[model samples]
Target: MPRQRTGGFHPRPTVLVAVGTDKHRFDRLIGWLDDWYAGSAARPTMVIQYGHSRPPTIPGAVPFLGHGDLQRAMATATLVVCHGGPATILEARRHGHLPIVVPRDPAHAEHVDNHQQLFARRLGAARMVALCESQAALTAALDAGLAQPRSFTVTADADVQAARLAAVARVGHIVEDLVAAAKPRRASARH
Candidate 1:
């Protein structure tokens, strides 16, 4: 069953932190938020770490919940900030929230040197999401986003259609290949 949301337009925006496999970006976000909250008393902050290990301390931060709390918290979040994990980005999109994506760098030995940076760069370039690098950039993004939180609205259905068409094409190709393979070998075309 699809997880139920926590409900309502939250007055205080939340930062939903999801770092499924990569720890570098996760640690960076945690430390940055910890510092941000420490210096500012204007608004409340919630840090949801969906990582494997216990998230490091973030002093005076609100509701450091376990994995069970993730779906609910994400539902309620006004601004979702996550490491560049495809699953997490898709979840943010599913929740109708435009995410702040700080992709995990694989070069620093952060998650087997995968495609995080590539994906993050792509989305960031398109302005489909915010990409955060330094703590300063994150602070700016946080303030701007929380000042007024906006949801992600799907404007085009082309991609969806394209995906479906691609699937059909692949299936057709497989069928053709199968038919050709199933044919018995010709007896040297002639006796």
Candidate 2:
């Protein structure tokens, strides 16, 4: 079984790569990230922040926190590349971390709705979030954003309330699932 790596990266330019997508979207994103990062002379270190216990180690890539540490670790990252979830976005902003938002597609079923798409659209418009739509876009946006970030207090964001509401909904889902699990299954009597 795959496990979260608590040990941090050794000393290279660190970039946090957070994902909430499955294999397909993940493979695509990883390939894209690798291709983009290949040519850079800087050779920045990457820490994969994800779940399902799959070893995220990609040779040059560094292993750090898994899904659980995502929010906390991302808060301390120099550059955060994350799935476009409101909570992740809010968390990155909370730590004053510069972010590159990668929207996981609907086809991947990464999320119920393509909130990433909507969030990307809004943040990209304001230039607060680096909306990486393509492999090339990732590099271009990363370069520009890293050069000079426009920092602001994360609490100032309007989406904070929405993230809090979403957290409540998630808790509700967990509780419902637990209740369902605890309930005894009804059985039919055989003739």
Query: Which candidate leads in TM-score?
Result: 1
Tens digits of lDDT, candidate 2, 120-167 = 677778765678878788887666544433331133344674465456
Task: Highest lDDT: give the candidate number.
Answer: 1
Model 2, global lDDT: 0.57
Residue 180 lDDT in model 2? 48
| Candidate 1 lDDT over residue span 82-168, tens digit each | 777665666665565667877766564454454566667777787756888778988877777766564332233456834643454
lDDT of each: 0.60, 0.57
- Misplaced by over 4 Å in model 1 are 1-9, 22-25, 50-54, 59-68, 151-191
